[model samples]
Target chain A: MKYILSFVLNGQPVDVLAEPTDTLLDVLREKLRVMSPKRGCDEGDCGACTVLLNGEPVRSCLTLALSVAGQEVMTVEGLSKNGKLHPLQRAFHEHYAAQCGFCTPGMILAAKALLDKNPHPTREEIVEAISGNLCRCGTYQEVLEAVQAVARGEYAEVKE
Target chain B: MGECIYFAPTEIGEAVRLLAEYREKVTVVAGGTDLLPKINYYQLKPEVLLHIGRLGLDYIKEADGKLVIGAATPTSKLASNPLVAERASALAEAARQSGSAAIRTTATIGGNLANASPAADLATPLLILDAELLLTSTRGNRKVAINDFFVGPGKTVLEPDELLIEVSLPHQKGKSVFLKLGRRKAMTLSVVNVAVRLEMEGAQCKDARIALGAMAPVPLRCTRAESLIKGQVLDKSLIDRCAAEAVAESSPIDDQRATSWYRKKAGTVLVARALARAADMEG
Candidate 1:
C-alpha cells in the first residue's frame, strides 16, 4: 500500500513515501512538513487546500499523491526568495487582508497562479481568479486590493 | 476508510489488463475531485484503485468530423477548447460554469460523466450534443450513447472490467444554449440546468434537442419538447408550449439545493430561457 512519490517541491526535487489513497495535501503537510496549504473542506468544494500543480492551481486535498508522481508542486512557503516575501504577501500585509490568517496561504497562491498567467490582470479578473478561495474573515475587499496592487506594477522587480 | 492499493498504468492495454485482472476489487479514479471525498468521508471503500492518470488518456481529438474527448480530458480544456467552443458552445459554457477554477483545472469531463450526478453540468450539454461514450475491456470495445450511459444517480452502466476510454460527438450543427441555476454564482450544484440545441432553416426549427439536469434520477432528454419544436417555426406561442413540455419531462425530488415544487417550476423557466437564447442565437 506504500508507494514512492517523486516531485519537484518549490525548486527542489523530493522523494517521499506515500499511500496511493493519501492526498498531496496530506503528504505535503504531514510527511513533507511543508504546511502552507490549509485543509478547509476535504472536498474540492473549497480552495483552502489549493496548490500549484505543474504551474496550474489545483485543489491539493482532492489530488491523490500517486497522481502527482514526478510532477512539480508549489505551496505558499515557496513564494518567497532570498528571505524577501513575495509581493502578494507584502501587499497582503500592507493592505491588512489577513484577519484570522488561515486563508492567507491559499489566497496568495491562488492569486499568484493568476498573476503568473496574467501579469496585469484587471480588477474583475483578479476577483474572478481568486473566487475559488473563501476568506471567512470578510477581507475580500482588501484581498482584491492586494492583488490589484501587485498588478499595478507595485513590485515589478519581484518577477525576477 | 481502510488500506487500499493503487495501480498506475501508462499504457491503455496494460490498464485494460489490470481492470480485467482486478475486477470489482478496483475502482477507476481520474480526477479524484469526487472520489477522494467519498473515500475520505467513508462513503466508498475499494481495496484497489485503478488510476488512469498516467495512461495518456487526457486528450481532445477530431476524427472524421467528430470531436473525440479522452476519458481523462480535464474540464478546463473543454471550457476553453476552440473546437469545443465553436462547435459545441453549450458544452464549453457548461464546462466554464462548472465548479471553480481549481475544480475545472483538475476535474475531467469523463469523471463528470462517470460519476453520473443528476446535477452534473456537463451531462445535459453532452446529452444534447448526442455524445457517444466508448468503453473498452480485455474482450474488446463498445460504444454507448451518452443518453443510455446513466442508470441512476452516482451510477453508470460501466462494468467492473470495462473502462471508459473516449467520448465522441459529431460537429454540432445548430445554435445551442446552456443555462445552469445553481445555489451560488460559483462552485455550487445546479438547482436545475437546461441545454437546448436547435437546427434552424431560416428560423424554422429543422430539428431540436432539449436536455435537463437535476430534474430526475438521471439527466433527461425532453423528446416531447423536441417534438413540439421540431419542424415548427418557433415563436412566442410555440416556445411557451415547448417549455411546458420540457417541464412535463421532469420528475425531481426535494433535496438540499432545491425543493421538488421549486424545481418543477424552475425547470420550465430554465428550459424556456435556454430555448429563447437558442432562438436569439439564430437571430
Candidate 2:
C-alpha cells in the first residue's frame, strides 16, 4: 500500500514514500512540514490548499499524493528565493490583501501561477484567476488590487 | 479503513487490465476533484485507486470530422481550446462556466459525465452535440450515445469493470449556446442549465436540439420543444411556446440549492435565453 513518489517540489527534487490514501495536502503539511498549503477544507471547497502543479493552480487537498509523481509541485513556501518574497507576496503586504492571513498563502500562490502564465493580466483576468480562492475575511477587493499590482509590475522589487 | 493501493498505468491496455483485475474494488481517478470529495464525505471507499492521468488520455483531437475528446482532458483545456470554441461552442461555454479556474484545471470531462449529476454543466452541452461515450474494459470496448449513458441521478450505465475512454462529438454546422443559472457567478452549482444548437436556413430553423439540466433526474433533451422549433420560424411566440414545453418536460426536485417551482421558472428563462441566443436575438 506504500509507493515511492519522486517529484520536483518547489525547485528541488524530492522522493517520498506515500500511502495511496494520503492526499497531497496532508503530505505537504504533515510529512514534508511545508505548511504553507493549509488544510482549511479537506474537501476542496476552500482554496486554502491551493498549490501549483506543473505551474497551474490546483487544490492540493483534492489531489492524491500518488498522482503527483514525476510532476513538478510548487507550494507557497517555494515562492521566495534567497529570503526574498515573490512579487505577489510583496503586493499582498503593500495592498493589504490579507486580513486573517489563513487564505493569504493560497491566494498568493494562485495569483503567482496566474501571473507566471500571464504577466499582465487585466482586472477581469485577475478576478477569474482567483475565483477558486475564498477569502472569508472579505478582503476580495484588496486581493484583487494586490494581484493587479503585481500584474502591472508595480511591486516587482518590493522587500519581503 | 484498510490501506488502499494506487496504480498509475501509462497505457490504456494496462489500465483496462487493472480495472478488470480490481473490478468493484478499484475506482478510476482522473482529476480527483470529484472523487476526493466523495471520499472525504465518506460516500465512497475503494481498496484501489487507479490513476489514468498519465495514459495520454488528455488530448483533444479531430478525427473524421468528429471532435474526439479524451476522457482525462481537463475542463480548463476544453474551455480554452480553440477547436472546441469553433466546432462545439456550447461545450466550450459549458467548460468555461463549470467551476473556478483551479477546479477546472483538475476536473476532467470523463469525471463530469461519470458523476452523472443532473446539474453537471457539461452534460447538457454534450447531449446537444449528440456526443457518444467510448467505454473500454478488458472484455472489449463499446460506444454509447450520451443520451443513453445516464440511468439516474449519480448513476450511469457504465459497468464496474469499464473505464470511460473518450467522448466523440459529431461535427455540425450551426450556432450553439449554453446558459447556466447558478447561485453565484463562480464556483456555484447549477440551479438550471440549458443548451441550444440551432441549424438555420435563412432565418427558418432547419434543425434544433435543446437540452436541459438540473431540472430532472438526468440531463435530458427536450424532444417536444425541439420538434416545435425545428422547421419553424424563429420568433418570440415560438420561443415562448418552446420554453413552456421545455419547462413542462422537466421533473425538478426541491433541494437545498433551489426549489422545484423555482427551477421550473428558471428553466423557462434559461430556455428562452438560449433560444434567443441561438436565433441571434439580443437584449
Candidate 3:
C-alpha cells in the first residue's frame, strides 16, 4: 500500500509516498537520493545505514518507512549547517577516523547522538555507543579517540 | 505489482480490531527491528503490516507495586530506566547488552519475547523476575506467565488475533544479576545467558530463581537448582552444585555459534557468576 509520510529531513520538510515494505534506508537512498546513508549490509548488522530517527540513532535498513511517519529524520547530510561540518565530522577528519569513508556517515551520526545525550561520556560509554557500527578496517581505537575528542568539546570550533 | 496493505492504528481498540480482522494475514510491528529483518530475510511474508507504534505504548511505569513495561518500550529505555535498574537489575543489564545502541534504540521488549529466540537476552531476566505478559485481542485481555509465553524457538502462545500489550514484573526485595556469554562484547548472539535472583535472609539464601538461555529450545528455569539453594547458605559447594544442576537442565544443540559441550560449560560458568553477583549484592 502507498502511505504518505511527512517528516522533517535535515531541517527540510519532506512528504514522500513509500510502500510499507520499503525500508527507511531504501526511501532515503532510492527515493530522496540522500545517499550519505549507505546500503552496506542491508541488514542491521553493519551500522552503515544508521540515521537519527527523532534524534535517536537507529539502523535505517531495519526501519520500515511507514513507521517513521511524522518523526524528525536526520541523515548525515543534515549534520552540517551553513556549509560547516558537525564537530564529530571535523574530529573524524582531524583524527583520521575514516579509512575508506564507507562507515564514516553512520559512525559520525552515532557519535552525534551520543554526544548530544551525553557530552562527557566515559570511554566505556563511547565504545558502547558505537558498538553496533562495524568498521571493517578495525580502526576502533582511532574512532574512539575521535568521538572522545568531540565529547570533550576540543573540536567545537574546528569547522568554524 | 501487488503491494501489501499497511495499517497504523492509533488506539489499542483499533489495533485489536485490525488484528482480529486481518487474522493470519497480519503481523504487528512496534520498533520493526526484528520483524523487518525477518521480512527482509523472507522468513515472514505477511499480507498486512499492522503498525502499533502510534498506540503510545512505549512507556515504563510503576503501578500497584509492579513495574509495568509497555510492549512497545524500546530496549534503550529499559537499559536506561532507573526503576528497572533498581528493581530488576538483571533486566536492565540484559537490556544494556541485548544489541548495539542503535539496535537497542529500535528493539522492543515485546519483539524480543515474541521472537522467542532461545538465546533471547531479555527472556532470562523476565523468567527470573516471574514477569507476566499481557495479551490483548478484540475478545479481551489475558495475562500469561513469561515461562508459559514461549512454546519453542520463534514461537509463542500468542493467538493470531491477540497482541502483546504489556509485561508486568512484580516488585520484589532481592538482588538480581544477568550474565551473557556471547562471541564478542557487543552485537553478538548469546551462546549462553544466565539470570539469577537471590532473596537473602541475612546472608542465608531464602529463595533463588535461576534462568538459563540458549541452552535449550526455550529459555528455562533451573527449578532443581532453585530448590537446592532454598533455605541454604550460598557457599562454594551450593554454587557448584547449582551450576552443575543448571548444566543438567540444558539441552543445547550444536549450532554454528557454539557446540553443545561449550554451551554446557558456559552455562555452568554463567550460573555461578550470576549467583555470585546476586550474593554479593545481598552482602
Candidate 4:
C-alpha cells in the first residue's frame, strides 16, 4: 500500500514513501518530522490540521497523501526564511495571540493564506478568513489584532 | 490500513473504465471533505479509493446559453466566479455559506451532490436553479435533472460505474436568494435552508421555484408552494399561505441539529423570507 509521493515541501522537492490512506498531516508530522501541523478533531471540523495546499488553506487531515503527490504544500514551519520568524509569527508573539499555542500555527497560517490574497483585509474580512480555525483559549481578538498589525505594516520585518 | 487501494487516474476515460471494472468495490473521492470524514468514522469502508482530482474536470464556463460547471469545481470558485454570481446568485450564496474558507477551498460541487446529505446547502440553490447533472460512464454520458438525482438521505441514483462530470443550468431571468438557519454562524450544517427564485413582472409574480433543504429525506422542491406563488401578485397573505404549503411538503426528523417541529416552523419562516427577498419585498 505504500507509494512514493513526490511533492514540493516548503521550497524543496521531497519524495516520501507513504500509504494510500495516510493523510498529508500524518506524513508531514510523522515521516518528515515536521510537527507544526497538529491533529485536532481529525474530521476536518477543527482547523488544527490546516496546511496550505498550493497556497490555499485546506484540512490536511481530510487530504489523502496521494492527493498531494504532485502538489506544493506549506506548513507553519515553512513560513519563515533564513531561520527568521515570519511577520505573522512575530505579530502573534508581540500581540500575545498564542494563548494556548495549540491553534496558533493553524490560525497564523490561515491568516497568511488570507493576507496573501488580501493584504489589506478589513476586520470583518479577517474574521471570515479565520472562521475555520477554532481557538479553545478564546484568543480570537488577540489573533485578529496580530493579523491586523501585520496587514498594517507594523510587523513587516522578519524577527531574529 | 493495508486493505484500501488508492487509484489516481490521469485520464477521464481510464477513470470511467476503472469504475466500470470495480463497481461497488470502489468509491470516488474528489475533495475528500465529506468522504474522508465518513471513512475515518468507519461509516463507509469501500475497498478502493478512486481519486478523480486530476481528471481536468475543474472548470466554470458558459456556452450555448447555459452555465456549465465541471464536477470538480470547488465551492470557492462557485463563490468567487463572476459568472455564477451574476447569473446564479443563489448558488453563489449557498456555496459561500456551505463551509468554512478551508472547507470551501477543497470541497468540490460534485462531492457535495454525490454525498447526498439532506442538509447539503448547495442542494437548495441548485434546485432553485433547475440544475442538470452530467453523469458519465464508460457507456456514455446522461444529463439528469436535479430533482430526480436523490433517492434518500446520504443516497443518490449515481451508479458505481458513473461519475458526475458537470452541472448545467440556464440563465434564469429572476431574482433568487438562499437562506439557512443553523446553530452557529459558520462551520455548521443547516437545520433548515430555503432557496427561492421568482420572476416578477411589475406587481405580479410570473414564475417561481421554492426549494427547501434539511426538511426532508432529500432536499425537496416545494411544488405546491411554487404553484401557489406562481402567477399570483405579491401579498403578505399569499406568501404566508405559500410558506404553509412549503411546511406541509417537507418531512423533517428529530436530530442533533434540530427537532422535526423546529425544522417545520423555522423552515416556514425561512421560506417566507426567501420568497419575499426574491420579490424585493419586506417580510
Best by the DockQ measure: 2
Residue B217 miss distance in model 4 (angstroms): 0.4
lDDT of each: 0.89, 0.90, 0.90, 0.91
What residue runs in model 1 are displaced by over 4 Å at the alpha carbon?
A: A158-160, B281-283
For B1-283, candidate 1 gives per-residue lDDT tens digits of: 5788988899999999999998989989999898989877778887998999888888888999999999899999999899888889999999988988888888998899999999899999999999999999999999999999999998899998999989999887788899999887777789999999988887699889999999999999999999998998888778889999998888989988889999988988888888878887323
By TM-score: ranked, best first: 4, 2, 1, 3
Taking the tens digit of each residue's C-alpha lDDT, what string does model 3 give over B1-283?
Answer: 2568999989999999999998998888888887877777777777899988888889999999999999999999999999999889999999999989899998999989988899999999999999999999999999999989999998999999999989999988789899999999899889999999999887699988999999999999889989999999878778989999988988999999999999998899889888888888322
Q: What is the lDDT of candidate 1?
A: 0.89
Clashing residue pairs in all predictions, respectively, total 0, 0, 0, 0
lDDT winner among the candidates?
4
Q: What lDDT score goes with residue B184 in model 1?
A: 76
Tell me the lDDT of model 4 at B138: 98
| Candidate 2 overall lDDT versus native | 0.90
Instruction: Chain A TM-score per model, please list them.
Output: 0.96, 0.95, 0.95, 0.96
The candidate with the higher lDDT, 1 or 2, is 2
How far residue B80's Cα lies from its native spot in candidate 1, in Å, is 1.2
* Model 4 lDDT per residue over A46-150, tens place: 899899999999999899888998899999888888888899999999999998899988998899999999999999999999989999898899999999999
Candidate 2 vs candidate 4: the DockQ winner is 2
